[model samples]
Target: MSAPLSRPSYAAVLRVPRARSTFAAALVGRLAYGVVSLSLLLATVRATGSYAVAGTVMALFGASTVLLLPLRASLVDRYGPRRALAPMAVLYAALLSVLAAVTWRPGTPAVVLGAVTALTGACAPPLGPTMRMVWGELVHDRRLLQRAYSLDGVAEELLYVSGPVFVGVLIRFASPSAGLLLSAALIAAGTCAFVASPVVGGLRGSSGRRQQGKSPARQRGLLQPVLVAAGAGLTLSAVDLLVTAFAERHGYGGDTVAWMLAALSAGSAVGGLLNGAIDWRTPARVRLPWQAAGLGLTVCAAGLAPGPWTLTAALACAGAFVAPALTTAYLIADETAAPGARTRAGAWINTAVNAGSSCGAVTAGLLLSHASLGVCFAAAGGAALVSAAGAVVGARGTAVAAVEAEPVPEAALEAESGRSGA
Candidate 1:
């Protein structure tokens, strides 16, 4: 038999010199998004002095963004990233500037704010999917690509953790407008730089298989991964609600809850890194259900913890399974998507996540009103268990293992291009 496969090192996988600038730029854009919903919510509340209006504004923006993402990704795939995103970047900035100004007007109509938010949401870039697609283009090795995604998962968690803090600081030291202004600036800069990067600048849509008369979007296996992603999102939101209720009930300070949440994020980042570093040799299809089940069960167990510290530990344990599950789902999406439709595929995964999170929050909230915290936790676990079932059933007959088993020629090309100094 051939030798056993060695674990892939993340350092070696990400050492693509030509890809660094693009990755960094996309990262900034992604991180900027972490602050947006919260900042806008705060801004809307400050302006209208009504939580209802603020909630409506934020909800519209989120829903619009999710609805428009597929279209945005399709545009990027049809045209090139540079051609598609550059104009969008400019328009997004202008709209944000307008929003900042409009929010300061006390008499601004809710409809007017809704329209602005809708337009702004439509303009939001598909940076997350774009970056991942670029990596698919830059790195051919399946193993290496997995590691890259792991890094991205870690970055995502970190950005979400710190982005709110950044926005809060800006709001504290400057004005409410400051957060929006900086977010606009960063998005603009990042989009411009990302589109100009060598790997993405002149890239065209993958029309090869489309010309051959097969559609990747219509593939049978795509729905499973999207469902899996949705399940992961649901679990996350459920846990968030659980922690919030736990803290409030126990008289724990907001800082304590934040630390507990931080521990979870930290565990996810660490798990993602470890998952990426080692070639577990398990197909994503096989890994996904187990990961989802693990997440659900962990969260359920956390509900049994007697104190904040115990809950924190349980959350961290649950978090460890989060990124690995997500990474697997993403990998599944990448593999199953039709050529030229990769961006839309990624967007679909995102859409599922958003929808699932909203559902999870609602479910947890309703449960919290009538049941003990443990019951809410149990429900969350049930949701995850359902997700795991979906994964198992959804992944039926997919050849993910065979695909990953194929030799990688892309990594060889990437290595020859240049290595990053990072």
Candidate 2:
């Protein structure tokens, strides 16, 4: 039998300057997102006095983000992130101030709050995708790109997991409004620094080509993958909501939710590291199913947890699959996208994630009001299973295509031939 294929080494991918700059930008943006996200969730609950209402507010917020993500991505691609980031940051801060002002009136109509929330969501810059694209452009070697993506994924997990705990502590001692205000300040400062960075400035002058013609129908078609990705995101979000609700029902309290979520983030960080380290010769189709299976199993096991600690463990296990899923989806989008559609593809994925999370939250709230938390967990678990099945199918197709593709470099072909001849 031929010798087993060896994976690409990380050493092959480590270019210094670009990697450092990408990491710095990603860290700054993630920190800003983390602060804002945690503050928003806590403040909404404090202001509304109902988890259901808070979920709704968050749903509206996500809806706005989903709607605006493509537009934002396009702008980033055209004008570059530096030019687009500043105004978005300013608008986001201003909108948060409005949200902080209106939040005190408790009796203020939900409709008004929702509108404001939507505006806040809309103003959120597509920082994650923009940064990812920057990494893709900046990193010349494929192996390095893999490492950069892995790093990006880790940063995301840290942001989400840590941000909430920090905000929760602040809200416990100070006030939720204070947390929100602080979030705004962080966003402003981070975005400003990111914009001012020389790396970003250099990118500004590179290109202004619109990816596609200004046809609405064509744009919609191009966005179909994003829509599918969004569906997946919504399902995952629902699972998260269910997990949180279930934890609370078991007398875990609000703080437990933070810990459980953190577990998931930790798992994701591990997954990202693994994804970066493994130079799989197998096509994505072979890998995607395993990733999805891990995610599904983790969700299902979470329902079997005996207590908060067990639940946290299960969620953390589930989180291990999160980054791989995200990475696979991004890779698929990159491979499948038409010329000039990269930004849109990235934006769509972000939109799907936010949209999915929003839907999940709403669904969890409804289920919590009527059914036992166990039912919600089971439902979420089932959804994850379904996602796994879909991923498997997609992976098979991708693998077949890869197998039929043209051969690689002469060295690679020779290596394969040599192994076979041996």
Candidate 3:
């Protein structure tokens, strides 16, 4: 039984130089993405003078991400992150520059902008998933994986919180194009640095398989925990929308909404740091419940906040659970995925979150347009409760046992990995 795969100590994992680099790369890449996202929204609005059209362009970008992400995951799985990172980063940078240039010209057709945006979207670097996969492969111990995930989650929150603010400030004081251009440069530099890092380049896939004279084709599957995590992601999306609407309704203007959102991200950053600081001896079962409770509390606080400041505090508290939940999900997914299918599983999680976000956004918009803000808050709180319930349920099952029974084929794993690494 491989000694039940005892969890590795936290200190042992932190000592890994590669893990540190991976985390740094993830942080920078995410920050760059945040800047680009805000810049794109502003640029589109500036160019078209139509919020509706700007929204459409952004939606297309999301659609492109949803469609192409899986393919990107496949490439990561097959070729490793090092091999595929550069092209994607370069292409993303190039596309962003093109977007800035075309938007600079007066009378640049919206159709042309939309087409470029979609094509550029395809170039998005699969940094998050690839990093997660690499962490899983390189870290080995389950406890280490949890810590890594916790840190990654925190970085994600920080990026979303700070990146947009930076972009917004730059656009207001400098030029909107500056934000976009900076985003490109950051992505290019970060991606290249990650690829060239000794830890990433020196690592080889399937050391165990090679020693045993087995081929890489021997690994692939459905990873049940990831699927459950994906479901939970849907719930989180719904909650996010509810919170946003609730803030807007309570006399919090657009700026307040941004701050409230940032509060949540900040909380996530805290959670991630906490995860990394904790001892690995703690069982996930115990840790997961506490995380869920935090999430529930966040919702309740957000729903009941009497003023904008109070609501922001509540949102931050709620946000603190974000990394823990993500850590739980990523750990589960890593355990359940077939060796080569890790990236796909991660990408699927991303897809689920995006889908959930889309649904939540639409629902929240409709509700806010027609109903009171309190109702939106209540709805969001309710959705968060659902997520908490799901996490509770997930905690009870073994990572491998929580997933579907069907096994993924080795060929499929290879194919998907290859596509992701590309």
Candidate 4:
């Protein structure tokens, strides 16, 4: 007989039948998102010769994407991913190709760039939210879901970091437009593989639609997690700008800024994995606020660091809370969603993060001019603390208590999960 498995590990997540292939395909496509934003910005600047134009185009793209997220996710819920996600990916890729060709040479018309970019953002497939929903479908056990989210979040963090580096390398030998073209290709291929996965094939049928029609599927508990998620995004972004200013004030080089950011990412990755490894009896709802508050406290302390090294250490410590917090939010999202509505639930969390990031960048900038660096950091932390407080207050007033995301019972698991086994 084969030796019995002893401990739960991230490896167990991959062992779920069809989950490995589905998740791998999703990641391949998601890497394109990491590459596209920077590549587009650089390509636009090169062609238009104006940072203002490039920045505006990027902002429009972000806003359009965030605004339409829930609607797109709703389409996926109403239709299966194969029906909904495929056309979206195809159109998005085609528009990206148009973007690449237009910006390949200098002097592309600004009007043309803006038009294509807005359309591209609108068509961008809701791959990340879809993937998280897939994880929910694949892993019925609560522990496995935690590991899956943690793993997914950590991998995503790395993808964004590496995406920029990849663009930098590509620009050295080729034009930034080449990176956009590559992103187009990556998304097309990855999305095709993802939709075609056997597990995804199980997500079809009208059961989801019927389930969503029921009153129990209302998803009343979403606000607390969403609020916390927004807070996390806001303060985390402020840390980026804060670190840049912190590095400059200390006479540190640009490399120090990079190192500090990288440290934050590393800490998040480690923390996420560690968080998943534990078997917690506590509900995600209970843990989430404390996680946000812990992050708030650490960021506030980061402001008090006396030296560059200490500040980096402080940021790293704060980042340790990052992935775990986001992971918990997604868990709550999955729990709160109805059978067919997981995509919409996850998309709301994504939207919250982006909205918070937009405000955070501007808020940090404004605070920098009027306040000391320490004050700026404190303000960032305070945002998170307020979010935590709001969650607590909202819970008290609401008729519905935010329920814990408990493991699905075996009978229900078999009915709900996709091509199960790990």
Candidate 5:
């Protein structure tokens, strides 16, 4: 077993052999994920001259991307990222390029465009899950993995922030189609480079082999992490619309909305870094509910702010909980994955967060129609409380023992990696 360090620096994570190159390539490919939605949404809206048409196309696209992620992830676990990711990235890029050309001028048929968008979304490579899986391989020491994931979560938040800014720049100078084409180029080039890395290149497929009888990922332990993740997603997604509504209600300008959202992102980034810097003795399963509840409470508190600046402050506090909750959940998911199921395990968390976000939009819309802003905030926070309570119940109610009660040794994790490869 690897000895636990007092505290592993985030710099130490990057120092792991081959980690920097693999991580950089993965980020380049994943940035395309961050960029595509806004780029495509704007392009579709411009092409159809109708928000309704664009909305439908985007809905289809998002649904395909989130719902089929597990299937895509399973392929990565089975065949390894080198083989699985490159082909998906190429096909996905090809579709996006087609979309850019089709949406260049107005009056494209909605159904035709929707078909292409859905196909494009379906082909999205599970880069985030695959990258996390690679992190598991690169760092066997638990402390280093914790630092690595925290660093990853923080970087991902920054990527989403930067992706929108990149799209905005394109819109300022060129067309939205330029962002789409840029997304295409990034994914194709980045994925090719990612696969060529020595770490990824060494992996092999043993999909049919039963090296492990049944993965713990298939057991009951995944429920808590997945549920908490979904709850976190729900509250976070609701904030976007809720803040906009608050701004409109107060007669604040659109920039107020942007500032509050940015505040929230800033908070998350700081929180993620802080979370990574610590070396906690508590198990992740023990810590998850507290983190979930913190997010819930802070968000509810944001609803009580009397002015825009106060609201920004409250949202920033809420944001602080976001990254820690997600990083903890991913840690649990990684621990649970076992053998040839790493990618799919991470994908489950991804799916829950996204599906919850989709639901959250509709939820906020309904609340805004019938309830006061305070009520909407309370209800969103209340959802997290329920999920936090449910995770505890779910863990105890199931027959399987709590997998997180004890740490799995590094040697066993190594065996898991060997089983996943040839």
Candidate 6:
């Protein structure tokens, strides 16, 4: 009989110098995103008295960010982190301030607000992907990198779960603007600190790391996994919207929405930790499709839940599969991309996620007007299944790419550090 593979330790991944500080700094900025979006949506609605208008405004922000993510990633790759992120962070914070001012003004046109929001989102740095790139730079071992990605997923889930509650409290006790203001402050502070941190590792190296060709998006076999990730994002956003719809349909309090969302995120965090600890011998290509399918099936079951508690439980179950699927997607993306294009690859995943979420929000809104809640849940399931199909179809290409891609050594990385503009 074959011996079992041992799992990687989270501690091993974090043992590198400056890892904790860099991770925490990036996390602050990421947490701000969770606060800003929903808070902005809610504030806009409160001011405009139109859910449609608010949603449109928020969607524009998400859309612009999705469209600009690759460009931003490319910039980061070419110019390095300090040059790319520092100015962008300042501008992003300034724009958020502008947004908050405009939102507070009564009778402000939604169109004008949306335009500003779009521009604001465009200015925001690709912090999440950039942080992952930092991880790839810092963690030399492939298994350690995998664990880092899992930890990233868990941190993101925690942020999404807690950020809303934080914003909710501020909105209830103080004002909706408070959340926006706080988010802006966090981004401004976090981005500057994160970009300037010595712990971010290095991006400039001449160890044959630089590629002289088209970006990863244009590369073969990259598009399908990106699309699959979009499907996963869509399902997640759909579930979020459905929870809101379910709360409103049943006349549940606003806090109920927070609890439901928290339940989902909590489950994801748990799953991520568990996933990171496991030593999976199977390739991501083999695991992703099954994980996505399972996520869909679980979410589909949520529609039939009889009560808030039941729905929360079902959503939690669905969330358990999310991090594993996302981890697989990231792995596949890294494998399929060119050496120099890893940052761009990570950005593509981020773009796909935002795009899918925006699309899901729109779809859920339409379904709520026409179909039953249960039906809407099934639609989310359908989207997840579609993602599964995409993953299955593209798995072979990524697997082949993985076999060909070589891991850069830690010594080579450090040697190249001095050459980085950052």
Whole-model lDDT, candidate 1? 0.81
Regarding TM-score, does 1 or 6 come out ahead? Answer: 1
Q: On residues 1-422, what C-alpha lDDT tens digit does candidate 2 reach at each position?
A: 11112343344334445455545655665576677666667677777787887888876776777788888887777777788888998998889888887775466677888889998988888777777776666665565566666777777777776777678788778767676677777777777777676666666522555445344433333343344355456556876677666765666677678677767777888888898887767765456556766776667677777788887888888878888777766665555555455666777777777766666667777877887666677766666566667656555554455455535777778787786445
Tens digits of per-residue lDDT for model 5 on 162-245? 998899888999889889999999899889988899888887655777644153434667888899999988888888899999
Clashes of each: 1, 5, 19, 0, 0, 0
Candidate 5 off by > 4 Å: 1-7, 211-218, 398-422
| Candidate 4, 208-254: lDDT as tens digits | 44566234324447777889889998998888999999888889999
- CA RMSD per model (angstroms): 8.7, 7.7, 8.6, 7.0, 6.2, 8.1
Best by TM-score: 5
Ten contiguous residues with the weakest lDDT in model 5? 211-220
TM-score of each: 0.90, 0.77, 0.80, 0.91, 0.92, 0.85
Question: C-alpha displacement of 73 in model 1, angstroms?
Answer: 1.0
All candidates' lDDT scores? 0.81, 0.68, 0.69, 0.87, 0.87, 0.81
Error of 3 at 335 (Å): 1.0
How far residue 332's Cα lies from its native spot in candidate 6, in Å, is 1.9
Q: Indicate the TM-score of model 4.
A: 0.91
In angstroms, the error of model 1 at 239 is: 1.4
**How does model 2 fare in lDDT?**
0.68
Off by over 4 Å in 1: 1-7, 206-218, 397-422
* Consecutive 10-residue window with the lowest summed lDDT within model 2: 1-10
Better of 3 and 5 by lDDT: 5
**Native-structure RMSD, model 4:** 7.0
Against the true structure, candidate 2 reaches a TM-score of 0.77
| Candidate 3 Cα misplacement greater than 4 A, ranges | 1-14, 172-174, 203-252, 280-297, 388-422
